[model samples]
Target: MRADAQRNRDHLLAVAGTIVVEEGVDVSMRDIARRAGVGLATLLRHFPTREALLEALLRTSFEELTARASALEASDAAREALVSWVRECVAWTTEYRGATELMAAAIDEPGSALHASCVTLRAAGARLLVRAQAAGEARGDLDGDDLFALIAMLAWAGDQPALAPRAEHLFDVVASAVLTGAGGR
Candidate 1:
């Protein structure tokens, strides 16, 4: 991409990210273009679709979380690492109002724009879960998919105005349930 084009794309992504957090993933394309001080055609040229724009905006975050999981994997406390990663994932997902639904759907849809990122993220979490389970820190019955579902569920709760107040408590409950004997040590 040309320098100017890349700059425009970056600006649009930054604007879109803020708007998505404020409004939602379903916010109109026109609104994003207006907010970015660009024409719809220009915005469309850079990101042909909403999903494309969102994929670009969110891919970096997903990669960061995945990298965080890797870093956490090296921690001596496996259970804490897993819990921390799960908390981070849920927090990130809740940042984008409608992202949890998209992530859940994208994980199952191979052709979705966000599929690869979501899959990699889930795999990263899965590795952490496996590590914890191996150390008898997490429940043996829980797998990556279950962890993914837990993330989505927790994120959903965080996104809700009513449940937002209880988000922390619910996270503690869910985390405690996932951990094994005596809070999985």
Candidate 2:
């Protein structure tokens, strides 16, 4: 793609992401085009359909999350590293608001672009969980699916502005319970 075309696509993705988080996935392409300061044709060229755009926006967030998770040094204190990574994931999900929902929807829809993007993050998180458990820093019984479920739940809870204040506390409680079997001191 040409530099200008790439710029236009980037702009569209940014604007579409904000709109999806703030408004919803139902927000029109025309609105995204307007927000991106681009024409409808340009928006369509970048993202042919609502699902395509939504998937692209969500894929971007998930890719970033995977990158962050992958960058975590496994050589560090396993428990601290796992906890820190989870907290960072929570923060990212909270900041992105509707990201969890988008991911869920994508997963539910077969052959989704977002579904492919999620695989790496899931694998990375599983690795972290396994390392933590093997080191006796986290509960051996806690599986990757459980951790993923917890993340989705917490992310959904954090989506509500009223519950936002307690998001960190909630994450801490969950992390402590999962890691220490009871709760962390």
Per-residue lDDT tens digits for candidate 2, residues 1-185, read 99988888888888887887678666889998988888999899889988788777777667777776667744576777778777777776766656777666655556776777766666778888888888777888877667776887888888887988898888878888888644461
> TM-score of each candidate?
0.98, 0.87
Name the 10 consecutive residues with the lowest summed lDDT in model 2: 176-185
Angstrom error of the Cα, residue 97, model 2: value is: 2.5
Model 1 lDDT tens row, 1-185? 89999999999999999999999999999999999999999999999999999999999999999999999999998999999999999999999999999999999999999999999999999999999999988999989999999999999999999999999999999999899978433
lDDT agreement with native, every candidate: 0.95, 0.76
User: Which stretches of candidate 2 lie above 4 Å from their native place?
Assistant: 108-110, 181-185
Best by lDDT: 1
> Would you give me the overall lDDT of model 1?
0.95
